[model samples]
Target chain A: MELLEEKIRKEGQVKGEGILKVDSFLNHQLDVALFEEMGKAFAKRFAGEGVNKILTIESSGIAIATSTARYFDYCPVVFGKKYVSLNLDQEIYSSDVYSYTKQQAYKIMVSKKYLDKDDRILIIDDFLANGKAVEALIDMVNQAGATLVGVGIAIEKGFQDGGALLREQGIALESLAIVDAMSEEEGVIFRAQSEKK
Target chain B: MELLEEKIRKEGQVKGEGILKVDSFLNHQLDVALFEEMGKAFAKRFAGEGVNKILTIESSGIAIATSTARYFDYCPVVFGKKYVSLNLDQEIYSSDVYSYTKQQAYKIMVSKKYLDKDDRILIIDDFLANGKAVEALIDMVNQAGATLVGVGIAIEKGFQDGGALLREQGIALESLAIVDAMSEEEGVIFRAQSEKK
Candidate 1:
């Protein structure tokens, strides 16, 4: 977690309107070594939860989720696909997510074959801004009749309502780095290490 | 390679129009253990190429590229993003690719900051069907003046022209499993191991 916070502080760019550009090592460009360490942290946090599956929403979350899956005894990582509108196939579990960034709603789906009642799911993502994506992922787990073990995130915008909202629902969410506040001039202000969930 | 081939034969669905869906392991529901094995195989094949960076396109390719990056001494993995019409920002390199599956063309862009002349890149992708995506990625690499060491594909549809064309160009292409032919009835018929490029 310290390593991730350090990496973010070093390379992450803080832009206007709460935009944190981490293309260097987080999103567009991936750092698998850091992902491995983050994976180990997730594994430790959700240690005995019997997590058989790791769920995330693409396109940014795939790398982190896949790397985290290795620590969970190589559990299958199922990512929800983004579609403007889905065909509502009966063989899949689908959920609607409202993207505040795009100011539009979209559907995220997972094949029913991958998630089911017997599975314990750990929802993972790169960023949890408003919690829309994580909520949709949790909805899919409910649809599959699966157990919601917890959620793991690489970065959580702490100033946003997402982290507070999920914690209110009693979800065991763990974010490697929580940006309490960030500004173009002052840079990123991370939440104290003693304060993370 | 044998492990991957076996997974495809067992779980891969043979859909119409030459679609071999191995979503259970390769793309949708990713198996990190399998990906790690794949990374090892790719490392062995592209050994001593000084592959310092792993390049891939987003969604399907990110997970594999992230896993593969581990074998490359935990190098940076940069993925091209798919956009309908990119803004052509001065900070990015963009390439056009026509997707036969969707019958539409899209632009894939990579940040100019991540790719440059000194980088040795190994492109990794989930599938190489028509090779349009890979070709577009190569175009971006060329635009950035980067060195392309080779390509590592999880599955190559040998019946398609992609593999043949790439090899014809004298590219160091290594496909873990090459499906020479396949059908719902006959399943998948892979090319002999010795026959691969």
Candidate 2:
């Protein structure tokens, strides 16, 4: 976690309207080495929770989830695809997600064949801003009658309500770096979670 | 490669209309152990090419590219984002890709900050059907004056023109499993390759 926090401080850029630009390392351009570190952290946090599968919404979440799956006995990572492809299964569990970053609502889907009542799912994502995407993934897990082990995130906008809401629901959510506040001029302020709980 | 081919034969479903759905283990639901094998194979193929970076498009490609990046000396993996985001850099190298799967022509953008002339990029993708997305990513690499060491594809539709065209261009294209034909009745037929050539 310290390494991630340090990397964010060094490369992440704070922008207006609570936006953090991490394309240089995290978002558009990924650091695979850092992803492995994050994977180890998630494995430690979610250890012994019967996590048989890793679930994430597509685009950004796939890399982190896939990397993290290696630590969980190489569990299958089922991503919620945003677009309907011919390759996707017809029988699926779908949910709507409202994106605060994109300012648009889209559907996230996972094939029913992947998730079942016997599976334990760990929801992972790159950023948890409004928590809409995570909520949708959780909804899909519920619809599939699977166990919701917990959620793992790389960066959590602490100022946002998503992390708070998940924690309020008694979900064991772990974010490697929580940005308490970020400004272009003031830099980034990460929440001190050493005393969490 | 034998393991991958076996996975496709076992879990991969052949639907009507020229579609082979391997969502059970490849794209939608990913197997991290299998991905590691793929990473090792790609590393072996692109070895000594000085592949400094792994380039890929978003969604399905992100997970594989991230997995493959680990085997390449933990190289940085930069994925081309399909949609415009608020945090994206204003300066970008963009290309148009017409997705026959989605039936939409979307722009793929990579931040100009990540890629440079000195970088040796290896493009990785989940599938190489018509090669539109891979071609667009190659174009983006050219736009940035970066060197494309080769293209690593998980599955290539050998019946399609994408694989043929890239091979004809003298590109070092390596596909783990190339399906020549498949049908609901006739089953899957793979184009035999010279042992890991």
Candidate 1 structure quality by residue, lDDT tens digits, B90-119:
478999998776678888999898998999
Q: What is the C-alpha lDDT profile of model 1 across A25-67, one tens digit per residue?
A: 8888898899999999999999998999999998889999988
lDDT of 2 by residue, A1-197 (tens): 79989998999888788989887777888888888899999999989898999999878888889889888989889989996786677899999988878888889898898899999999999999889999999999999999999999999999999999999999999999999889998899988878443
Each candidate's DockQ score against the native complex?
0.62, 0.86
Error of 2 at B176 (Å): 0.7
Q: Clashes in model 2: which pairs?
A: none
Restricted to chain B, the TM-score per model reads 0.96, 0.97
How high is the TM-score of chain A in each model? 0.95, 0.97
Q: What is each candidate's fraction of native interface contacts (fnat)? A: 0.80, 0.95
TM-scores, all models, native as reference: 0.96, 0.97
Error of model 1, residue A13, in angstroms: 0.8
